[model samples]
Target: MIILRTPRLTAHLAVAALFGSSLLLASCADADTTSNTSSVSSSASDSPTSPVSDSSAEGTGAGNGGTDSGASMLPSGSSSSADEAGQGVGGNASETEEAPKTSDEAVSEAVNRVNRDYPNKFGGWVFKGDTNFDSAADLTYAKVEQAQQGNAQYETLLIFFHKGEYLGIDSTYPQQVVSTAPSSRGLEVVYKDWEALRDSGDANAAAGKYTSTVTYYWDGAQVQHEGRIPNTGL
Candidate 1:
C-alpha cells in the first residue's frame, strides 16, 4: 500500500505496509506539516499554478497516488558500503558541488515563490514567508498547517523543487520526518540504512516520517529531473 510521508510522523504510519519504494517529502518543522508513496514523479509542467490545499487530492495534493517513484533509502548493497547512499539514478554531481552562492535577495525571492506557488492543502498551515536555506540552505522556509500543531485538518505532502526552490518552514519543534533534499553537499553515508524495519524501510513516509526530496536544474523556467532521482525522499 502507498502512504504519505509526514513530519513528526509516528512509527505506526512510517512502518505501514511497504509496497514499491521511494521518498515522499514531508512538512519540515521549520514550517510544520506532512505523505507516503510507493513512487513519485513530478516535472515543471506538473508544477502548481495556483494555491492548493493539503486536503485536496489534486495535482499538488499529498494524497496523490501517481505511482511514480523517487530515490530509494539506500542504493543496492548500501549496507556493505556506505558510499552508495546518495548515488541514486541520475544523481547530479554539480548540484553537490560548490557554487558562487545565493544572495539574501535571492533567498527572499525563493520564499516569495513558495508562498505564491507552494502547496498548502494541509490544515492550520499558512504561508509565513520564509526560507530555511541559509545562504544556500537546502530548503526555503514557509509555515504550513498541521494537526500535530493543533491545526484543524491534516494531510501529507511532497515538495519537488531545486536546491533554492525548497523552503524549510519552521524547525522550532519536532514532527514526523524532517524535510531532506538530495545529498547535494556530498555528505558521507557512513551508516546509511532503511528508516523502517526489515524490508519496510523502503516504503513511503507520508503518513509517518518525512518523505519526498525534490532537486532539479533551473534555467529561468525549464524544470527537469532528468538523470536525477524521482521527486520524493527523506
Candidate 2:
C-alpha cells in the first residue's frame, strides 16, 4: 500500500492536506481500476471464443465407420464370389433353354415305344411291321417233276415279280392242296418273300376249296430253305 504525507500540523493546513490526500487516493484508485479493466479487455480480445469443431472428421467418413472413400462395404471376396455364382446360374439356364430336341433322339425313343397302331391292314406288305425283314436279292423257285400226292401231282409253274424292294411269288393250285408236302420235308429257307406269303394266306382263305385244277398267285416270294441262317451278325 502507498500513502501520501505532508509536514504542516495547523488545522487549516491539515484540512488542505487531507483534501489533497483524498483526491490523490481517488486518482490512484481510478487508475488501478482502469488498469484492471484494460487487462481484462486485452485478455478477452486475445482469447476470443474459439470453439474447435470435429466436422471435418465427420465428413471424412469417420462418423459412420472411419472407412476410406469409395471403398466396398461387403466382406473380402464376397463380391467376386457372388458374380461367379450368378454367371454359373445364367449358363445353366441358357443351356436348358437353348438346347433343342433332335430327330435322332426322338427316333431312339420311338424305336423303344410299342406301336399299338401297326399294320392297319390284315394281309399286306407293311413297312416296319410286327414281322419285318430287309434284304436285297431276287428269289425264284423251279417246278418239281413227277411229285404226286393225294391224287395230285406237285408240278406247277412259278412266276417272279420285282415289286420295287420286295419279290412277289405267283403260283396256282388247281387241285386239292395238301397241308404239308410229305415228300418235301426239311426244306431250306434260303430266301424269304413275306409279301407273297401274306397275300397267299388271304387268297387261300377267300378260295374255300380247290375242287378242280386251279391257279394260285402270291404277291411275295417262295420258301427256298427252312431255317437257313446266313451272316446273322450283319
Candidate 3:
C-alpha cells in the first residue's frame, strides 16, 4: 500500500524497528541460557557421584552391606594374625619381652618349684609365711617346718638358695627349735636341743630352757657347724 511517509513518522518507525530487533536478540539469548542450564542439570542427575565399577560395588555390598557401612567394616584390635605379629615387631620391647617379676613373685615361684619337684620330700612341711609360728626369712633363705599337728614339737629346716637356685638344707633334730639370722658373709642358724631335757624329773624343764645350743653358718658351698655350748642346769 502506498502511504504518505512523513519525516517524523519515518524516524519513529526506524527507532521502533531497532528496539524490536534488540528485544528479539535478548529473548533468544535468554532461551539459549535456560536450555544450557537444563542440559547441565540433566547430565549431573544421570551421572554417578563417584566412579566405581559394578563388580567392586557388588563385592563391597556383599561383605560390607552398602557403600556407607559403619565401623564394623573397619579393622578391629585383633583383626589379623599379621597385625598381631606387627605389634611385636620392630622395637616393641614391652610387647616382645615379659615384665620383670617382683620379689613376691620370685618367692612364690621358688616355693612352687620346690613343691612340684620334690613332692612330700620335706615331710609335709609348711612354709614360713604360711604359719604364724614359723619365721619368715630373706629370699636367700626359706624356713620350712614339719607340720605340727597336736604336738608342740616339730622339726624345722632352713633352705638355702642363691638367686632362685636351691643350694642345700640345714635341719634341726626332732623336738629341737631352730632360728636363723643374717650374717656378714652369709646366714647363721642356731639350734636349741631341748630333747635332752626329756629325761629331767621336772615336768616343765623341757619347755623352760634348752639343754644345749649349736651354731651353724653358711659358707657359700655348704653349711658348717661352728660350735656348741651345753647347759648344765635348766
Candidate 4:
C-alpha cells in the first residue's frame, strides 16, 4: 500500500471516496425497487380474471323459478288433461230423451184425427163420449149419432181407432142399445135390442135376454173383427 504524502490531502480524498460510494448504493437500491414493481405489473396483466355477465345470471334465475310457479296455477280437484278433454262440470252427458205421451193427449189425438179426416160427414152429428174418452190396449173407440130432434132417432154408428189411426166402423140396428168394454185381448162391443124385450112383455126380459156380443181386436196392420154371437134368451 502507498502512504499519503500530506495529512490534509489524504483526509479530503477519503471524504470524496465515501460520498461516491453512498451515491452508488442509493442508485442501485432505486433500480432494484423499480425492477420489482415492473415484474409485478407484468404478471398481473398476463393472468386475466373473467367477469360474470348479467344475462347469464338472469337466465339461470328464470329457469329455476319457472318450474315451480307453473304447477301452482292449476285449479283444485282437476288436472290439465281433464281440461284438455273438455269434461263438463257435473261430469255427465246431457239428457235428450223426450217425455212419454199422456192418456188425455192420446184421446185428443184421436179426436183430432177424426175431425181432420171426416169433417163434412159428421157436422151436425154428436160424439157419444167426447168428454170421457178412455183409450185401452192401444185402441180407442167413439160412437157418433145423429142429433135427436123431437125424440126421433136416426142412424147410430161406432168408429174404431188404434193409436190415432182410423179403422173400420160398424153400426147397430136402429133404436138398439150398444155398450163397450175393454179387455187384455181387445174391445168388446155388445148390442141389445130393448124393443124386442118390450114387445115380448116377459118379466124375465129385464135380465138382458136379447144381448148380442161382438169382439174387435187389433192385428198390427189393421183391426180384426170376430163373428157375432147369437143372443141368449133367458
Candidate 5:
C-alpha cells in the first residue's frame, strides 16, 4: 500500500496532453475555414454574370426599380374616354362655315342698285331765268337746297308747262305741289302756274325783304337734291 505507481501516473499525463493539443488544432482549423468561406461569398456577390459585357449595373437597377417601365407605356382607354367627353362631337363646326355679309355692305349695294335703275331722267332743265306769263318762259328743274331758304332738299324740278297741262294730268299737279311745299301756304296761287310766283317770292326773300325762304323737294327716290336762292344783295 505504501509503494509509489509512477508509470501509471506518467501514462495518464501523456493521454491528457494529447487530448488538449487535438482540441486546439481543431478550433484553429474551424476559425480559418469560417473566414475563407465568408471571403468567398463576398467575392461571388461582387462578380458580374456576363464577363465581356457592355451591359451595366445601372440598367439592371432601373429594371428592378420599376418606375421607368411604367412611364414608357401608353395611357389606358379610360383616359381617351375622358378626352372625348371634354371635346364633344360638335366642336369647331361653326368655325368651318362662312360668315354672312355686313350691314354696311348691304346698304351700299342697295344704293348702287337704285342709282343704276333711275339714272338722272330729268337732266338739262334750265335752272335760272326771269318769270313769264306765257308758256314760252324758261322753266327749270332745280334741287331744294334749304327748306327755309327757298331751296329744295330733293330733286324738285321746275317746269314752265301751262297750269292746265300739269293740273289736268293724273298724278301730276297736286302730288308735285304738295311734295314740293315745305309747309302749306294760305291763299296759294290758284289759277296761274304757281312756279313763277314761288320763284319770285324766293328771289324777294333772298334780297332780305322777307324773314323766311321757300324751297322745293322731290318725294319718290333714294337720292336727294337741294336748291339755293340767288341773293339780290349780290
Candidate 6:
C-alpha cells in the first residue's frame, strides 16, 4: 500500500508541472502578438498618405512669398525707367526747337528768285540814269552828264543805285521828263510778275506802283539795311 501511494503522488506532481508550463507558454505568445500589433500601428502612423496634397500646400506657400517680394520691388524700378525715357524725349525736342535761321539764307533765297523771274527786264548795269529833262539842250543836263562822264562814275553810280533800289538797272537815261526835279524820285521797284520776290516778303503795289522808299547801303563788302516792308498791297 505505501509503494502504490508513492507512485501515485509522483505521477500527480509531474502532471501539475506540465500544466504550469503550458500556461506560461500561452502567456508569452499573447505578449508577443500584442507587441507585433503595436509595431504595425506605429509604422502605419509614420507613413505619408496624401503626398500630393502636402507638396501642393508647401508649393503654394512658396509661391505666395515670391509674389509678395516681387510686388514690393516693382514701383521704384518702373518709375525710374519711365522718367529716363521722358527726359530723353524732352532733350531731343528742345534741340530740334532751338535750331537757328540765318540771314545769309534769307538773302540768297531773295536774290535767286529775282534773277530767275526777271531775266530780261533787269539789265546788266547796276544803275539807271534818269535826267528829268526833255532834250540834249535841256536846262539841268550838264551837271548829271558831267558826273556820268567822269572816270569813277560807274562804280559810284553802282553803289548809289544798289543803296537806293536793291535791283539791277539799264545804262541809258529815260526819254521823257516825268518830273521837273529829283525829289523822292529814286525808288526800289520790283515787277508784278516776279512771284518769287513777291513771296519772299517784298512790298506790294499801291496806286499802280510797287515801290519801296527804304534806303540801302553797301559797306564795302556786303549790303546792309534796316527796314520792314509790308508784302501785301495797301
Runs off by more than 4 Å, candidate 3: 1-106, 109-123, 130-139, 172-178, 199-205, 211-214, 218-220, 228-234
Q: What is the C-alpha lDDT of each candidate?
A: 0.31, 0.28, 0.44, 0.47, 0.29, 0.29
* TM-score of model number 1: 0.24
Predicted candidate 2 versus true structure: per-residue lDDT over 199-227, tens digit per residue: 45755343433222211222132222222
> Which regions in candidate 6 have their CA more than 4 angstroms from the true location?
1-4, 49-234
Clashes of each: 62, 14, 0, 0, 17, 0
* Candidate 3 local lDDT, residue 10: 87
State which candidate has the highest lDDT. Answer: 4
Evaluate model 4: give its TM-score: 0.37
After TM-score superposition, what is the CA distance of residue 98 in candidate 2 from its true location, in Å?
A: 59
Better of 4 and 6 by lDDT: 4
**Residue 34 accuracy (lDDT) in model 6:** 93
Q: Write the per-residue lDDT of candidate 3 for residues 66-173, one digit (tens) a residue.
A: 222221111111111111222222343222333444545645554565455434533566676721111222225666666655465555555444333343343322
- Per-residue lDDT of 130-183 in model 1, one digit per residue for the tens? 224444433233333342443311332222223443322211122222343344
Which ten residues in a row are the worst by lDDT in model 6? 73-82
Worst 10 residues of 4 by lDDT: 56-65
lDDT of 5 by residue, 1-234 (tens): 698999999999999889989999999999999999999999888754422212211111101112222211111110100111122244421212224324333233323332343234444122232122222211112111112222432232233112101110111121122223322321111112234435566652342332222232212211112222222122
Worst 10 residues of 5 by lDDT: 74-83
TM-score per candidate, chains pooled: 0.24, 0.17, 0.39, 0.37, 0.19, 0.19
Error of 1 at 143 (Å): 7.5
Q: Alpha-carbon error at 121 in model 1, in Å? A: 4.5
